[model samples]
Target: MSIRSVITTADEQVPFAAVKERIVQAMCAAGLGAVLLFGAGFSSMETLHNAAHDSRHSAGFPCH
Candidate 1:
Protein backbone atom coordinates (compact mmCIF):
# COMPACT_ATOMS: atom_id res chain seq x y z
CA MET A 1 0.00 0.00 0.00
CA SER A 2 1.16 3.57 -0.74
CA ILE A 3 1.67 6.25 1.93
CA ARG A 4 -1.15 8.35 0.43
CA SER A 5 -3.59 5.44 0.77
CA VAL A 6 -2.84 5.15 4.49
CA ILE A 7 -4.16 8.64 5.27
CA THR A 8 -7.87 9.01 6.04
CA THR A 9 -9.87 11.88 4.49
CA ALA A 10 -12.52 14.04 6.16
CA ASP A 11 -15.90 13.26 4.59
CA GLU A 12 -18.02 16.07 6.10
CA GLN A 13 -17.98 19.86 5.83
CA VAL A 14 -19.89 22.26 8.12
CA PRO A 15 -21.49 25.29 6.48
CA PHE A 16 -20.88 28.75 7.94
CA ALA A 17 -24.58 29.54 8.24
CA ALA A 18 -25.31 26.41 10.27
CA VAL A 19 -22.36 27.09 12.57
CA LYS A 20 -23.50 30.67 13.11
CA GLU A 21 -27.04 29.60 13.88
CA ARG A 22 -25.87 27.03 16.46
CA ILE A 23 -23.64 29.62 18.15
CA VAL A 24 -26.49 32.14 18.32
CA GLN A 25 -28.82 29.55 19.85
CA ALA A 26 -26.26 28.62 22.50
CA MET A 27 -25.68 32.28 23.40
CA CYS A 28 -29.39 32.98 23.74
CA ALA A 29 -29.90 29.95 26.00
CA ALA A 30 -26.97 31.01 28.21
CA GLY A 31 -28.33 34.56 28.46
CA LEU A 32 -31.77 33.31 29.47
CA GLY A 33 -30.29 31.05 32.19
CA ALA A 34 -28.22 33.91 33.58
CA VAL A 35 -31.25 36.20 33.75
CA LEU A 36 -33.30 33.58 35.58
CA LEU A 37 -30.50 32.97 38.12
CA PHE A 38 -30.11 36.69 38.75
CA GLY A 39 -33.83 37.15 39.28
CA ALA A 40 -33.93 34.27 41.79
CA GLY A 41 -31.00 35.72 43.76
CA PHE A 42 -32.57 39.17 43.81
CA SER A 43 -35.84 37.75 45.11
CA SER A 44 -34.04 35.86 47.91
CA MET A 45 -32.16 39.00 48.93
CA GLU A 46 -35.37 41.01 49.03
CA THR A 47 -37.00 38.41 51.25
CA LEU A 48 -34.04 38.45 53.64
CA HIS A 49 -34.11 42.24 53.84
CA ASN A 50 -37.81 42.24 54.66
CA ALA A 51 -37.36 39.60 57.38
CA ALA A 52 -34.57 41.61 58.99
CA HIS A 53 -36.61 44.78 58.88
CA ASP A 54 -39.54 43.06 60.55
CA SER A 55 -37.32 41.66 63.29
CA ARG A 56 -35.79 45.03 64.00
CA HIS A 57 -39.19 46.69 64.18
CA SER A 58 -40.51 44.06 66.61
CA ALA A 59 -37.50 44.62 68.84
CA GLY A 60 -38.32 48.31 69.15
CA PHE A 61 -35.09 49.39 67.40
CA PRO A 62 -35.05 52.17 64.78
CA CYS A 63 -33.60 50.73 61.55
CA HIS A 64 -33.69 54.10 59.85
Candidate 2:
Protein backbone atom coordinates (compact mmCIF):
# COMPACT_ATOMS: atom_id res chain seq x y z
CA MET A 1 0.00 0.00 0.00
CA SER A 2 1.00 3.59 -0.51
CA ILE A 3 2.51 5.47 2.46
CA ARG A 4 -0.48 7.86 2.60
CA SER A 5 -2.93 4.97 2.48
CA VAL A 6 -1.11 3.18 5.32
CA ILE A 7 -1.15 6.34 7.42
CA THR A 8 -4.82 6.86 6.77
CA THR A 9 -5.64 3.30 7.81
CA ALA A 10 -3.65 3.66 11.03
CA ASP A 11 -5.36 6.98 11.79
CA GLU A 12 -8.78 5.40 11.33
CA GLN A 13 -7.89 2.72 13.87
CA VAL A 14 -6.75 5.18 16.56
CA PRO A 15 -10.14 5.23 18.25
CA PHE A 16 -10.33 1.45 18.38
CA ALA A 17 -6.80 1.31 19.80
CA ALA A 18 -7.76 3.81 22.49
CA VAL A 19 -10.87 1.84 23.40
CA LYS A 20 -8.91 -1.41 23.61
CA GLU A 21 -6.31 0.22 25.82
CA ARG A 22 -9.02 1.55 28.13
CA ILE A 23 -10.61 -1.87 28.43
CA VAL A 24 -7.28 -3.49 29.26
CA GLN A 25 -6.56 -0.86 31.92
CA ALA A 26 -10.03 -1.28 33.44
CA MET A 27 -9.69 -5.07 33.57
CA CYS A 28 -6.29 -4.83 35.27
CA ALA A 29 -7.67 -2.36 37.82
CA ALA A 30 -10.63 -4.61 38.56
CA GLY A 31 -8.39 -7.62 39.06
CA LEU A 32 -6.13 -5.68 41.40
CA GLY A 33 -9.09 -4.37 43.36
CA ALA A 34 -10.47 -7.84 43.78
CA VAL A 35 -7.14 -9.09 45.08
CA LEU A 36 -6.87 -6.21 47.55
CA LEU A 37 -10.50 -6.16 48.63
CA PHE A 38 -11.22 -9.87 48.86
CA GLY A 39 -7.92 -11.73 48.82
CA ALA A 40 -6.02 -9.48 51.22
CA GLY A 41 -9.12 -8.58 53.20
CA PHE A 42 -9.68 -12.23 53.98
CA SER A 43 -6.03 -13.14 54.31
CA SER A 44 -4.76 -15.33 57.17
CA MET A 45 -2.13 -12.70 57.92
CA GLU A 46 -3.45 -10.39 60.61
CA THR A 47 -1.81 -7.26 59.31
CA LEU A 48 -3.14 -7.57 55.77
CA HIS A 49 -6.60 -8.51 56.98
CA ASN A 50 -6.73 -5.63 59.42
CA ALA A 51 -5.53 -3.11 56.88
CA ALA A 52 -8.20 -4.12 54.40
CA HIS A 53 -10.82 -4.16 57.11
CA ASP A 54 -9.88 -0.66 58.20
CA SER A 55 -9.90 0.59 54.64
CA ARG A 56 -13.37 -0.79 54.07
CA HIS A 57 -14.67 0.79 57.25
CA SER A 58 -13.08 4.13 56.37
CA ALA A 59 -14.59 3.98 52.90
CA GLY A 60 -18.00 3.28 54.44
CA PHE A 61 -18.17 -0.12 52.81
CA PRO A 62 -19.95 -2.46 55.19
CA CYS A 63 -17.95 -5.55 56.16
CA HIS A 64 -20.46 -6.94 58.61
Candidate 3:
Protein backbone atom coordinates (compact mmCIF):
# COMPACT_ATOMS: atom_id res chain seq x y z
CA MET A 1 0.00 0.00 0.00
CA SER A 2 1.08 3.55 -0.63
CA ILE A 3 2.06 5.74 2.32
CA ARG A 4 -0.91 8.07 1.73
CA SER A 5 -3.32 5.14 1.61
CA VAL A 6 -1.87 3.74 4.81
CA ILE A 7 -2.29 7.08 6.56
CA THR A 8 -5.87 7.36 5.33
CA THR A 9 -6.69 3.87 6.50
CA ALA A 10 -5.28 4.58 9.93
CA ASP A 11 -7.28 7.80 10.20
CA GLU A 12 -10.46 5.98 9.24
CA GLN A 13 -9.85 3.42 11.95
CA VAL A 14 -9.31 6.01 14.69
CA PRO A 15 -13.00 6.46 15.48
CA PHE A 16 -13.63 2.73 15.58
CA ALA A 17 -10.65 2.20 17.90
CA ALA A 18 -11.84 4.94 20.25
CA VAL A 19 -15.38 3.49 20.37
CA LYS A 20 -14.11 -0.02 21.08
CA GLU A 21 -11.88 1.31 23.84
CA ARG A 22 -14.84 3.12 25.44
CA ILE A 23 -17.00 -0.03 25.36
CA VAL A 24 -14.30 -2.14 26.94
CA GLN A 25 -13.71 0.45 29.66
CA ALA A 26 -17.44 0.68 30.39
CA MET A 27 -17.80 -3.10 30.66
CA CYS A 28 -14.83 -3.31 33.01
CA ALA A 29 -16.28 -0.56 35.21
CA ALA A 30 -19.65 -2.31 35.36
CA GLY A 31 -18.06 -5.62 36.25
CA LEU A 32 -16.04 -4.00 39.03
CA GLY A 33 -19.12 -2.24 40.37
CA ALA A 34 -21.03 -5.51 40.47
CA VAL A 35 -18.22 -7.21 42.33
CA LEU A 36 -18.01 -4.44 44.89
CA LEU A 37 -21.80 -4.09 45.23
CA PHE A 38 -22.62 -7.78 45.65
CA GLY A 39 -19.39 -9.53 46.61
CA ALA A 40 -18.25 -7.05 49.20
CA GLY A 41 -21.68 -5.80 50.23
CA PHE A 42 -22.83 -9.28 51.28
CA SER A 43 -19.61 -10.79 52.50
CA SER A 44 -19.58 -12.99 55.60
CA MET A 45 -16.30 -11.49 56.74
CA GLU A 46 -16.68 -8.65 59.18
CA THR A 47 -13.72 -6.74 57.78
CA LEU A 48 -15.05 -6.70 54.25
CA HIS A 49 -18.52 -5.76 55.46
CA ASN A 50 -17.21 -2.95 57.60
CA ALA A 51 -15.01 -1.64 54.84
CA ALA A 52 -17.85 -1.57 52.40
CA HIS A 53 -20.12 -0.01 54.96
CA ASP A 54 -17.64 2.69 55.78
CA SER A 55 -16.99 3.40 52.16
CA ARG A 56 -20.69 3.76 51.51
CA HIS A 57 -21.14 6.03 54.47
CA SER A 58 -18.22 8.17 53.42
CA ALA A 59 -19.69 8.44 49.96
CA GLY A 60 -23.07 9.41 51.42
CA PHE A 61 -24.83 6.40 49.95
CA PRO A 62 -27.21 5.87 52.88
CA CYS A 63 -26.68 2.17 53.70
CA HIS A 64 -29.29 2.36 56.44
Best by TM-score: 1
Cα lDDT tens digits for candidate 2, 14-36? 67888999999999999999987
What lDDT, from 0 to 1, does candidate 1 have? 0.86
lDDT of each: 0.86, 0.84, 0.84
Candidate 3's residue-wise lDDT over 1-64, tens digit each? 7888656654355678888999999999999999988986677798887887999999999998
When sorted by lDDT, best at the front, the candidate numbers are: 1, 3, 2
lDDT of 1 by residue, 1-64 (tens): 9976777568656689999999999999999999977866778777878888999999999999
TM-scores vs. true structure, each candidate: 0.52, 0.47, 0.49
Q: Candidate 2 has what TM-score? A: 0.47
Q: Quick one: best lDDT, which candidate?
A: 1
